[model samples]
Target: MVPILDYLLQRQISPQWRGLLTALAEEFETQIGQGELRQLMYRVGCRFAAAAPLPPCSSTADLADALNACWQETEWGYVELSDEPEYLRIAHSCAPLLGFGAAALSWTPAFLEGVYQTWLSALGAEGLSVVQASEFDEHATIEFRLGRHPV
Candidate 1:
Protein backbone atom coordinates (compact mmCIF):
# COMPACT_ATOMS: atom_id res chain seq x y z
CA MET A 1 0.00 0.00 0.00
CA VAL A 2 1.20 3.54 -0.68
CA PRO A 3 1.84 4.92 2.81
CA ILE A 4 0.88 8.52 3.60
CA LEU A 5 4.49 9.61 3.64
CA ASP A 6 4.94 7.91 0.31
CA TYR A 7 2.29 10.18 -1.13
CA LEU A 8 3.44 13.43 0.54
CA LEU A 9 7.07 12.97 -0.36
CA GLN A 10 5.78 12.51 -3.89
CA ARG A 11 3.96 15.84 -3.74
CA GLN A 12 6.11 18.97 -3.53
CA ILE A 13 4.54 20.80 -0.62
CA SER A 14 6.49 23.78 0.70
CA PRO A 15 8.49 23.55 3.90
CA GLN A 16 5.68 25.11 5.93
CA TRP A 17 3.03 22.98 4.31
CA ARG A 18 5.40 20.07 4.74
CA GLY A 19 5.32 20.59 8.48
CA LEU A 20 1.55 20.64 8.40
CA LEU A 21 1.62 17.42 6.43
CA THR A 22 3.89 15.93 9.05
CA ALA A 23 1.43 17.01 11.70
CA LEU A 24 -1.41 15.39 9.83
CA ALA A 25 0.61 12.22 9.39
CA GLU A 26 1.27 12.08 13.10
CA GLU A 27 -2.38 12.71 13.80
CA PHE A 28 -3.31 9.86 11.51
CA GLU A 29 -0.73 7.59 13.01
CA THR A 30 -2.12 8.32 16.44
CA GLN A 31 -5.59 7.54 15.21
CA ILE A 32 -4.36 4.47 13.40
CA GLY A 33 -6.37 2.09 15.54
CA GLN A 34 -9.36 3.51 13.73
CA GLY A 35 -9.13 1.75 10.41
CA GLU A 36 -11.88 3.94 9.00
CA LEU A 37 -9.71 7.06 9.26
CA ARG A 38 -6.88 5.41 7.41
CA GLN A 39 -9.35 4.19 4.88
CA LEU A 40 -10.58 7.74 4.43
CA MET A 41 -7.06 8.85 3.77
CA TYR A 42 -6.56 6.06 1.27
CA ARG A 43 -9.66 7.24 -0.54
CA VAL A 44 -8.51 10.84 -0.57
CA GLY A 45 -4.88 11.55 -1.32
CA CYS A 46 -2.95 12.27 1.89
CA ARG A 47 -2.66 15.92 0.79
CA PHE A 48 -6.25 16.30 -0.34
CA ALA A 49 -4.94 18.08 -3.43
CA ALA A 50 -5.99 15.59 -6.10
CA ALA A 51 -8.05 18.45 -7.49
CA ALA A 52 -5.01 20.60 -8.16
CA PRO A 53 -4.53 21.75 -11.75
CA LEU A 54 -1.03 20.48 -12.19
CA PRO A 55 0.82 17.58 -13.69
CA PRO A 56 1.13 14.25 -11.93
CA CYS A 57 4.38 14.20 -10.01
CA SER A 58 6.74 11.42 -10.95
CA SER A 59 7.82 10.89 -7.35
CA THR A 60 6.35 11.29 -3.88
CA ALA A 61 8.94 13.87 -2.90
CA ASP A 62 8.23 15.81 -6.04
CA LEU A 63 4.50 15.66 -5.28
CA ALA A 64 5.05 17.14 -1.84
CA ASP A 65 7.32 19.83 -3.24
CA ALA A 66 4.85 20.70 -5.97
CA LEU A 67 1.98 20.82 -3.52
CA ASN A 68 3.99 22.89 -1.09
CA ALA A 69 5.03 25.24 -3.84
CA CYS A 70 1.43 25.38 -4.99
CA TRP A 71 0.50 26.45 -1.46
CA GLN A 72 3.16 28.83 -0.13
CA GLU A 73 4.51 30.14 -3.40
CA THR A 74 1.61 32.43 -4.14
CA GLU A 75 1.56 36.03 -5.38
CA TRP A 76 3.55 37.69 -2.64
CA GLY A 77 1.38 37.45 0.49
CA TYR A 78 -2.03 37.99 -0.97
CA VAL A 79 -4.46 35.04 -0.55
CA GLU A 80 -8.25 34.93 -0.42
CA LEU A 81 -9.04 32.65 2.44
CA SER A 82 -10.86 33.51 5.66
CA ASP A 83 -9.89 37.04 6.70
CA GLU A 84 -9.75 36.04 10.35
CA PRO A 85 -6.07 36.12 11.22
CA GLU A 86 -6.40 33.21 13.61
CA TYR A 87 -8.18 31.07 11.05
CA LEU A 88 -6.07 32.43 8.25
CA ARG A 89 -2.99 31.58 10.21
CA ILE A 90 -4.08 27.95 10.40
CA ALA A 91 -5.26 27.87 6.78
CA HIS A 92 -2.54 30.12 5.39
CA SER A 93 0.04 27.96 7.03
CA CYS A 94 -1.02 25.08 4.78
CA ALA A 95 -3.62 26.37 2.36
CA PRO A 96 -2.92 25.98 -1.39
CA LEU A 97 -1.68 29.12 -3.11
CA LEU A 98 -4.85 29.79 -5.07
CA GLY A 99 -7.71 32.24 -5.46
CA PHE A 100 -6.77 35.88 -5.04
CA GLY A 101 -3.40 34.69 -3.89
CA ALA A 102 -2.73 32.79 -7.12
CA ALA A 103 -4.23 35.72 -9.02
CA ALA A 104 -1.71 37.89 -7.29
CA LEU A 105 0.99 35.80 -8.90
CA SER A 106 -0.63 35.19 -12.31
CA TRP A 107 -2.68 38.43 -12.41
CA THR A 108 -5.50 36.26 -13.76
CA PRO A 109 -8.81 36.87 -12.01
CA ALA A 110 -9.94 33.42 -13.15
CA PHE A 111 -7.13 31.91 -11.16
CA LEU A 112 -8.74 33.31 -8.06
CA GLU A 113 -12.16 32.19 -9.23
CA GLY A 114 -10.70 28.79 -10.01
CA VAL A 115 -9.47 28.50 -6.47
CA TYR A 116 -12.94 29.38 -5.20
CA GLN A 117 -14.49 26.74 -7.39
CA THR A 118 -11.94 24.24 -6.23
CA TRP A 119 -12.81 25.04 -2.65
CA LEU A 120 -16.45 24.39 -3.37
CA SER A 121 -15.67 21.04 -4.98
CA ALA A 122 -13.39 20.07 -2.14
CA LEU A 123 -16.20 20.74 0.29
CA GLY A 124 -18.39 18.36 -1.75
CA ALA A 125 -20.67 21.15 -2.84
CA GLU A 126 -22.70 19.69 -5.69
CA GLY A 127 -25.38 21.81 -7.27
CA LEU A 128 -24.45 24.63 -4.93
CA SER A 129 -24.63 28.33 -5.66
CA VAL A 130 -21.96 30.70 -4.39
CA VAL A 131 -22.58 34.43 -4.38
CA GLN A 132 -19.40 36.47 -4.03
CA ALA A 133 -19.33 40.11 -2.93
CA SER A 134 -15.94 41.76 -2.55
CA GLU A 135 -15.21 43.61 0.65
CA PHE A 136 -12.55 46.29 0.42
CA ASP A 137 -9.07 44.83 0.02
CA GLU A 138 -9.72 41.23 -1.03
CA HIS A 139 -12.60 40.46 1.28
CA ALA A 140 -15.62 38.61 -0.10
CA THR A 141 -18.71 36.65 0.92
CA ILE A 142 -19.61 33.19 -0.44
CA GLU A 143 -23.28 32.53 0.12
CA PHE A 144 -24.19 28.95 -0.77
CA ARG A 145 -26.92 26.32 -0.61
CA LEU A 146 -27.02 22.50 -0.66
CA GLY A 147 -28.27 20.54 -3.64
CA ARG A 148 -30.66 18.42 -1.61
CA HIS A 149 -32.12 18.47 1.88
CA PRO A 150 -29.53 18.69 4.62
CA VAL A 151 -28.75 15.36 6.17
Candidate 2:
Protein backbone atom coordinates (compact mmCIF):
# COMPACT_ATOMS: atom_id res chain seq x y z
CA MET A 1 0.00 0.00 0.00
CA VAL A 2 2.85 2.32 0.87
CA PRO A 3 4.55 1.56 -2.40
CA ILE A 4 1.37 2.25 -4.33
CA LEU A 5 0.91 5.51 -2.47
CA ASP A 6 4.54 6.37 -3.23
CA TYR A 7 3.97 5.68 -6.88
CA LEU A 8 0.93 7.92 -6.86
CA LEU A 9 2.93 10.61 -5.10
CA GLN A 10 5.76 10.34 -7.59
CA ARG A 11 3.62 10.14 -10.70
CA GLN A 12 1.99 13.09 -12.35
CA ILE A 13 -1.09 12.09 -10.41
CA SER A 14 0.41 14.36 -7.75
CA PRO A 15 -0.86 15.32 -4.34
CA GLN A 16 -2.60 18.30 -5.85
CA TRP A 17 -4.63 16.04 -8.07
CA ARG A 18 -5.40 13.75 -5.19
CA GLY A 19 -6.33 16.75 -3.13
CA LEU A 20 -8.63 17.93 -5.86
CA LEU A 21 -10.35 14.58 -5.96
CA THR A 22 -10.77 14.69 -2.22
CA ALA A 23 -12.09 18.23 -2.46
CA LEU A 24 -14.72 17.11 -4.89
CA ALA A 25 -15.71 14.32 -2.60
CA GLU A 26 -15.83 16.74 0.29
CA GLU A 27 -18.02 19.12 -1.62
CA PHE A 28 -20.43 16.32 -2.39
CA GLU A 29 -20.26 15.25 1.24
CA THR A 30 -21.44 18.63 2.46
CA GLN A 31 -25.02 17.88 1.53
CA ILE A 32 -24.85 14.44 3.09
CA GLY A 33 -23.07 15.64 6.20
CA GLN A 34 -19.74 14.45 7.52
CA GLY A 35 -21.17 11.51 9.45
CA GLU A 36 -22.95 10.15 6.43
CA LEU A 37 -19.82 10.58 4.35
CA ARG A 38 -17.81 8.74 6.98
CA GLN A 39 -20.26 5.84 7.05
CA LEU A 40 -20.29 5.67 3.31
CA MET A 41 -16.53 5.70 3.13
CA TYR A 42 -16.29 3.09 5.82
CA ARG A 43 -18.53 0.76 3.85
CA VAL A 44 -16.56 1.42 0.70
CA GLY A 45 -13.34 0.76 2.52
CA CYS A 46 -14.72 -2.50 3.80
CA ARG A 47 -15.41 -3.64 0.27
CA PHE A 48 -11.92 -2.59 -0.68
CA ALA A 49 -10.54 -4.59 2.22
CA ALA A 50 -12.44 -7.62 1.02
CA ALA A 51 -10.56 -7.42 -2.24
CA ALA A 52 -7.07 -6.50 -1.03
CA PRO A 53 -7.05 -8.20 2.37
CA LEU A 54 -5.06 -7.16 5.42
CA PRO A 55 -2.51 -9.31 7.18
CA PRO A 56 -3.82 -11.17 10.19
CA CYS A 57 -4.21 -9.20 13.38
CA SER A 58 -5.81 -11.15 16.21
CA SER A 59 -6.40 -8.41 18.71
CA THR A 60 -7.01 -4.68 18.65
CA ALA A 61 -3.58 -4.07 20.14
CA ASP A 62 -2.06 -6.27 17.51
CA LEU A 63 -4.06 -4.47 14.88
CA ALA A 64 -2.70 -1.14 16.05
CA ASP A 65 0.82 -2.52 16.04
CA ALA A 66 0.33 -3.88 12.55
CA LEU A 67 -1.03 -0.54 11.35
CA ASN A 68 1.91 1.27 12.88
CA ALA A 69 4.24 -1.05 11.02
CA CYS A 70 2.26 -0.61 7.82
CA TRP A 71 2.41 3.18 8.10
CA GLN A 72 6.16 3.16 8.74
CA GLU A 73 6.79 0.83 5.83
CA THR A 74 4.86 3.04 3.42
CA GLU A 75 7.14 6.03 3.97
CA TRP A 76 4.01 8.14 3.88
CA GLY A 77 4.36 8.78 7.60
CA TYR A 78 5.07 7.46 11.05
CA VAL A 79 2.54 6.47 13.66
CA GLU A 80 3.28 6.13 17.33
CA LEU A 81 0.83 4.16 19.39
CA SER A 82 0.15 4.77 23.04
CA ASP A 83 -2.37 2.43 24.57
CA GLU A 84 -4.64 3.98 27.12
CA PRO A 85 -7.07 2.17 29.37
CA GLU A 86 -10.03 3.43 27.41
CA TYR A 87 -8.64 3.72 23.91
CA LEU A 88 -5.60 3.71 21.69
CA ARG A 89 -4.08 7.11 20.97
CA ILE A 90 -2.04 7.27 17.81
CA ALA A 91 0.19 10.18 16.96
CA HIS A 92 0.64 10.42 13.23
CA SER A 93 3.49 12.35 11.66
CA CYS A 94 4.15 13.24 8.03
CA ALA A 95 1.14 11.37 6.65
CA PRO A 96 0.56 11.89 2.95
CA LEU A 97 -2.28 14.28 3.79
CA LEU A 98 0.28 16.92 4.66
CA GLY A 99 1.02 17.22 0.99
CA PHE A 100 -2.63 18.00 0.28
CA GLY A 101 -2.40 21.48 1.88
CA ALA A 102 -4.64 23.09 4.47
CA ALA A 103 -8.04 22.98 2.82
CA ALA A 104 -7.81 19.34 1.81
CA LEU A 105 -6.66 18.25 5.23
CA SER A 106 -10.24 18.14 6.42
CA TRP A 107 -10.91 15.34 3.99
CA THR A 108 -8.43 13.05 5.65
CA PRO A 109 -10.11 12.57 8.98
CA ALA A 110 -13.28 10.96 7.66
CA PHE A 111 -11.41 9.05 4.98
CA LEU A 112 -8.95 7.64 7.47
CA GLU A 113 -11.76 6.96 9.85
CA GLY A 114 -13.35 4.86 7.15
CA VAL A 115 -10.16 3.05 6.31
CA TYR A 116 -9.36 2.30 9.93
CA GLN A 117 -12.89 1.23 10.69
CA THR A 118 -12.77 -1.18 7.78
CA TRP A 119 -9.40 -2.51 8.86
CA LEU A 120 -10.61 -3.13 12.38
CA SER A 121 -13.73 -4.84 11.14
CA ALA A 122 -11.71 -7.04 8.84
CA LEU A 123 -9.62 -8.11 11.78
CA GLY A 124 -12.86 -9.23 13.44
CA ALA A 125 -12.63 -6.51 16.03
CA GLU A 126 -16.08 -6.35 17.51
CA GLY A 127 -17.25 -3.28 19.38
CA LEU A 128 -14.59 -1.02 17.94
CA SER A 129 -14.61 2.41 16.39
CA VAL A 130 -11.89 4.63 14.95
CA VAL A 131 -11.81 8.37 14.62
CA GLN A 132 -9.45 11.21 13.88
CA ALA A 133 -9.76 12.56 17.34
CA SER A 134 -7.60 15.69 16.89
CA GLU A 135 -4.97 17.39 14.74
CA PHE A 136 -2.13 19.89 14.71
CA ASP A 137 0.39 21.15 12.20
CA GLU A 138 1.97 18.18 10.46
CA HIS A 139 0.42 15.81 12.96
CA ALA A 140 -2.86 14.03 13.67
CA THR A 141 -4.12 11.85 16.45
CA ILE A 142 -6.31 8.82 15.72
CA GLU A 143 -8.35 7.40 18.50
CA PHE A 144 -9.37 3.76 18.47
CA ARG A 145 -12.10 2.84 20.89
CA LEU A 146 -11.77 -0.84 21.52
CA GLY A 147 -14.35 -3.08 23.15
CA ARG A 148 -17.05 -0.48 22.57
CA HIS A 149 -19.27 -1.19 19.62
CA PRO A 150 -20.05 1.49 17.12
CA VAL A 151 -23.47 3.01 17.63
lDDT of 2 by residue, 1-151 (tens): 2555445544523555766776676575557765665566567656654555568976657766777776666564556666687776656555565344445555545555666667766777667777666653522434434346456
Among these predicted structures, which one has the highest TM-score? 2
Taken over the whole model, the C-alpha lDDT of each candidate is: 0.36, 0.58
lDDT per residue (tens digit) for residues 1-151 in model 1: 1355334333434555645645654565466544454345334532344455544555435434543566565422223333232211111221232222222222222233344344444545455423223311222212212223333
Error of 1 at 46 (Å): 21
110: Cα error in model 2, Å: 1.3
Candidate 2 Cα deviation (angstroms), residue 121: 2.1
TM-score, one value per model: 0.26, 0.61
Q: Kindly provide the TM-score of model 2 when superposed on the true structure, using C-alpha atoms.
A: 0.61
Model 1 misplaced stretches (Cα beyond 4 Å): 1-69, 76-108, 135-151
